[model samples]
Target chain A: MSSDGCSSPSGPRAAVGDRVVPGPGRAPAGTRQPLVRFDSVWKTYRTGAEPVHALRGVSVSVMPGEYISIIGPSGSGKSTFMHILGCLDTPTSGRYSLAGTDVSSMGEVELAEVRNRRIGFVFQQFHLLARLSAWRNVELPLIYAGVPRHERRVRAMAALEQVGLANRVEHRPNQLSGGQQQRVAVARALVTEPDLLLADEPTGNLDSRSSADVLAMLDELHRSGRTIVLITHEPDVAQAAERVKRFRDGRFIDDGGEGR
Target chain B: MSWWETMRSGFDAILGHRLRSGLTVLGILIGIAAVILTVGLGEGATAQVNSAINSLGTNLLIVSPGSSSTGLVRGGFGTASTLTYANALALGNKRDCPDVAAVAPQVQTGGNLVAGTTNWSTQVIGSTPNWLQVRGRSMAIGSFFTASQVKTDANVVVLGSTTAQELGLFNPVGQTIEVGTVPFTVIGVLKSAGTSSSSTNQDDMAVVPVTTAQELLTGTPTVSNIYLEATSASTMGAAGTEVTDELLALHGITDPANQDFTITSQTSLVQTASSVNSALTFLLAGIAAISLLVGGIGVMNIMLVSVTERVREIGLRKALGATPAMVRRQFLVEASVLGLTGGIGGAALGLVAAVVVPHFVSNQIAISVPATLGSVAVAMVIGVVFGVYPASRAARLAPIEALRSE
Candidate 1:
């Protein structure tokens, strides 16, 4: 993993509009570029007799190990932005690259491979299959990755341990509490060792205590040098990230906030 | 996913909805059972016909009067009185028809048999002493009439077992019976031959001398038919041809199509019976196949509903990195398993029915192995063919749209 703005735990954060320089690391120059780069991406939906512009010329970049939050009310294009970032939908125009590979024009099969190997998504609904246990849910991505069964089980157990759900590996999603289900989803997201973690309203269905626990888990992951992108409408959730980007009417607006 | 894992998931899905899956299987089961029963009864009928024909006599040939055409309308077999005792005599000449072993000339007429106070209508067959040899029959009491009796035109007769029984005479030899007011003495009794495959009772007639039948009963020299037995089964074909040629020469018939006589071998009779049986079998199978088609549609309908109900699950799997091909494979395997299971169950049921039916019905039920195997294969094909559209529909679902479904 590469270190950027989030390397120092107690130092004063860089001001807004300041470019994040590479921190002291052993990575070569070729690998120190931003992990995510989107140059004026656009998305248009034509579902209901007219074209709906879900995204319009949105441009952004994020360095490695940075925790960025995209906050917007409903119908503000935040979900569309998360979809594009998670590789679930393709951008209509402009360049979108992840880990140096341009993915804007990729086909469905290639995009699926990218989502399986490079990106992990945490949806608001948890999305755990009701039939499978927590460990089996975590093992799903590795199963698609063609990993051996024994090794997939081992890595799934390790991920469950990371989310503090080590004792609940055999419990199904319905048997677990809302906070525990969210933790299982997190473990599932991390099991593939993806380069980017995309959390979309991770605390939307949880109580305050579970939401606090989930936010604290994301903060810990960011501190441990993982790239995290959080999408939420809650101010407290946005405050946990090092930077916040505001959106309204299908375009990004200036939130004007530095790391706190 | 590995093939083992795919199969496991498919079986689990089938097991999850027990009632739905069972009903689907039942449809296929009924189809397969119908196929088995139809084929089994057809095969049994064919075997019964074959055995009946075989029991008549392996190397016997029957020479009957051929059709007679009058302008546009033509008559069927035994319509023309072309066969005669002269033809039998000429065929019996070993130097002329070396393939023939024995010959019997028959003259048949129906009349009431009178014995004391009992009276019954029965066919009286007039033949020579060689009738028993050519027909592969034996006397159960007393002895067969000698050739001397036929030559002398004696009024002695041999009674069939059923004829004797109906006359209330267990020991009918030397007893006198009236045939159209002519009293004839019974000399022997033939053993019962049971009912033929064509459903004709072969034991309800009496035998007499052809000479007596012609001069006294019918007052004509014409005989109804002639039966010839070959020296061996292998010579039956040649014996039939020889009889045809000899009869045509004796009648001075030059054109082959205008022949006065028809010579038929036992093998040809068996062949005709089996061909008719096979045609009936095909007709029955065609009717049964309609049910199989309906069963396939049932599978398709159920699978389509399953796909619709599990749209969100499909989306979840896709988002979890499952390929479209994998989704299709899982559903296809599930449908095939249902078909195969139903096929096995139906075959077992059909076999049990075949075994148990003989006690209640006279029709034989034969379970042919090839037909059973063929039904099983067709059932599996039905499943795979019907499953394609539903599985492809599931595979084509968009991940985002499917996940959006509740």
Candidate 2:
């Protein structure tokens, strides 16, 4: 049912959904450097007087154009892991790198630049600004990137088209359905063409049909030689990935094997 | 992002909350309006007083008797009769004082005037034919009493516009009116001179020959005051000094301070009026400026509330690659727009008040250009000054924490 072993091993190959043809197969982890690296990362939260250890000495790595899922129940540090990987939050201690850049020790400004250029985040809530139109929401990242007005509009429209929402460009969030809103958010994330697409429960708030649609879109993105790291507790959602890492009580219990 | 786009987005944010922004702007509007209105009214009052002082007489001087002190029981100026027609004649001599233009000696007293069944209380001023020339007055009807009429002590008088109106005589020339139980023929009616800078009505007196007043009305030969005009405004100081010296020599008073006669010039009167008006203007404007400070505080309060309310928006923007500086610029621009709108609206309101207020008040109210400009500038400054704390607070917010604020 899944199109496994079809991701391109080379840098940024074009992907046309089911029509996409596989390139030279990726090398094994032992023979190549990874695009994402985490060395014994720990995340602690000081809510009040006592500290809660969210992530305890966890380590993981991801390669380019690889689809992976990090699955865990609530309080298993899965969300914290996604936050650190997206550069939204830093580790309490230990080194982390993305696209060969050390991001663990970066300041807020530098991290923000790294997040803008290298990462695209899709949240469970869809996080589309309610006031802006669908295309305007998609154009937001380009605006921050200092893209000129005409080019930002063109690229935003193109990205919306990629998500099959070309006719809903002028629709506001409230005017669109849940699945369409998620698609618009996906378009927003894709507009920047970042190296990593980190989705934290991208379909958690949608109905069964909408959730299926979002999951299928993510699978299609993975088939198109795009990197996707989806965080979810649903087995059905995680099963779509080629590989999976299971987390329990802030520790990874199972690192699924790679396959071709 | 570019500064233009940042400003545009900030304006959009401000527009999103119209009622809140409007109320905030109203506070600043009242403040700026108060400042502009007060300044306009003050300027108008000062201008009115200055023109009134100018119309009193051109380069004229009034020499009146100083106070008489009887063992510290002092009597006010104009209470003694040290000035006389002889001193006036001496001052008017061309060889003695070429700077002196015209001289009109006068003795004044308040009395009742009766014509037919109408009666009015008015000031009766005794003077010569040169009264019109020295006082800068013009005859509206017949001529003034000639020199021969003054020497003969003719019972002829010239009625001022107000006095004529009071006596119910529009054309008073050749009409008879009783002054102190003696019938006097009105030879002329003086044109309206309006009011003085001191706010006293100038056209409420009747003028008669000085000899007629001394011999027939007051029954005394002692004159009370002398009016002298300089040939040119530039020569007033020299003319004043010459008149004082001539009076002192005539009266045999050596010390200048102890001289019984005192000389007051038009220039001094104008200077005094201007200084007093300027002080009043500053006081009024100062009181009005306090409201502007309060308006600034209002702006700061609104901005702080806005920053607190938009924490999530701030987080979203920060996540989208906006720098802390960019965030600060956005809020600052929003605050400035609020202030600019309020300032311009208030200035327009003040301009309307400047035009409309004169209809209600006795004095003219005028909008001063500098004050209008300054009020706008002050509003802008208040915006920036109050906007900083809130903008900095928004800029310093951590993205993760702010996003979690819901």
Candidate 3:
């Protein structure tokens, strides 16, 4: 056992080769439990009778107010990992704790509660209800969270305002520009003030200019103490995050030789 | 949000597709109208029949000379003439039959009623004072003939409204009207009793004393029919039975089958007519219900298409934290809106049909608004019932998969 609480670089921490270690200097200032933790998580899907392992013995931890990026190629299990972190799917064999609660053992209803109350998801498609106005789309999370009508309206409006979409609140997805629509999605994600904001290729469908705009907004959200986990196949998008974990063949590979 | 707001939001969604919603509602409207119109026509016809029967007389029985089956196949009068003056008198004298209010013998004869230059063919009936009370016919102008006039074979006469109008006798009270060659004085004119299309003779009729009618026309004292009145409405059936038994005994007939005269009551005739009307109404309603079923099926089909089209919307809502119940409620609200709007339109159409059709075809047709409302309610139920499956299917869709779809 080590005398200090921090694991030594030459000790058992070195045995797990190529695993990015957390830097001692980057430890959170305040004492708070990790918002997300995955222990020996294994996810398998049956393509016909043969089981294909998507994630094998993957362990990870995410603290509050941390901006992380998950980078991978096609079929590298990054999407599956995003699904697990967003509470949209449970790991087949692992203890997955979210917001200090072991969600791997939670029932469907509890998982839905977690998804509703703690996790906000943004998809590459912008996933805004096409029939609803930007404001109504943002209010969707509050509706799920059972927020009162007046407060929900206020919070949704404020979220839209935060995303600088105050004037486009009444515009539907088709009526708004691609960048504006993504901002509306962002507003929706932040409306409930969830513990985690998960974005998966959020700017994949946007042009470079719109992509930079969305990336800047994400960066601002990170600086404002929002915990964001974004997934992307592009290195430029991943570089915008404080930390990037590269996934390949169901395993994490360190590229910059830095801690998580 | 309040439940009302939720409902209102659902309503807004339904209204968003105005044309589709209107078309779906049209199906329900037609269904409700069919049910209401069919039921209304049947009920109206029944009411007309009952009124027609009652117009004949309250205590009157139509004793045709033959039985229905015998007349239908044999094409002649059946074997039985138990109806006589003596039988009428015996029924009137029965102490045990308190229901026997009065009895009057009647004989019908067709003749030309002539007054001055006007001449009209009319049915001349010979009846006593009891006929007026039993038949529910009273003198509108002059008084009906007294019992003495019937016994003495006097030439007093009463004229029906049509008969008086045809003869150009506006107020010919105490005026003599010649029937064939016999001169009879019209002592009274009857009030207008509306005639049914089924029976044309009801409008054209004349009444005279029984003896005078027998002596002038048939040249015999025998009567053709007997009209009887019950003491009260409640004892009509008892009165009919007593009159039948007394007539049978007086004619020395042992078997009821052997008797000639038919004893009928207004209550029985009215009851029979009402039952027939009920059956007709059921048949009409049944036929209409088939159309309603088709309309309901149309609603279901449209709703299914709507659900499929709105799959993406449903998915996004679910992804945003809408429970399955909320999704179901939204669809249900949409369906109910369709049904409700359709019901209103159908009811309006039916009302127009009820009002307009009667004027063009006949004035007797009646439309009941409550019946229309009932149909509307039924249409709404059909909409809800048909909408459930499609709504549930939309609600049960997986949020992620739905959102992923284009």
Q: Write the per-residue lDDT of candidate 2 for residues B1-406, one digit (tens) a residue.
A: 8988888887888788899999989988988999998888778777778777766678899888886555657678767777777777788898878899999998888879999889999889999888888888888889899999988999998888888998899768899999989999999888888764347778888889998898877877777788889999899999988888888888887867667778999889888888888898889878778888888888999999999988987887787777788899999988888888889999999999888877776777787898899898888888888899999999999877777676
lDDT of 1 by residue, B215-259 (tens): 888888889989889999898888878888888789887877877
Off by over 4 Å in 3: A1-30, A250-260, B67-82, B195-203, B220-222, B363-373
lDDT of 2 by residue, A190-231 (tens): 999999898889989999999989989988998997889989
Point out where model 2 deviates above 4 Å: A1-33, A40-58, A91-93, A233-235, A248-253, A257-260, B94-99, B110-122, B137-198, B203-205, B222-224, B230-239, B254-257
Better of 2 and 3 by lDDT: 2
Error of 1 at A65 (Å): 3.4
Backbone clashes for every candidate come to 0, 0, 2
Per-candidate DockQ versus the true complex?
Answer: 0.44, 0.54, 0.36
Tens-digit per-residue lDDT, A113-151, candidate 3: 788888888889887767678998898878767788889
Top candidate, metric lDDT: 1
Estimate how well candidate 3 is docked, as a DockQ score: 0.36
* Regions of model 1 farther than 4 Å from truth: A1-31, A46-50, A161-170, A223-225, A255-260, B66-76, B79-82, B98-101, B106-198, B201-224, B230-241, B248-261
Evaluated on CA atoms against the true complex, candidate 2 attains a DockQ of 0.54
Model 1: CAPRI class: acceptable
Interface RMSD of each: 1.4, 1.2, 2.4
Roughly what TM-score does model 3 have, to 2 decimal places?
A: 0.88
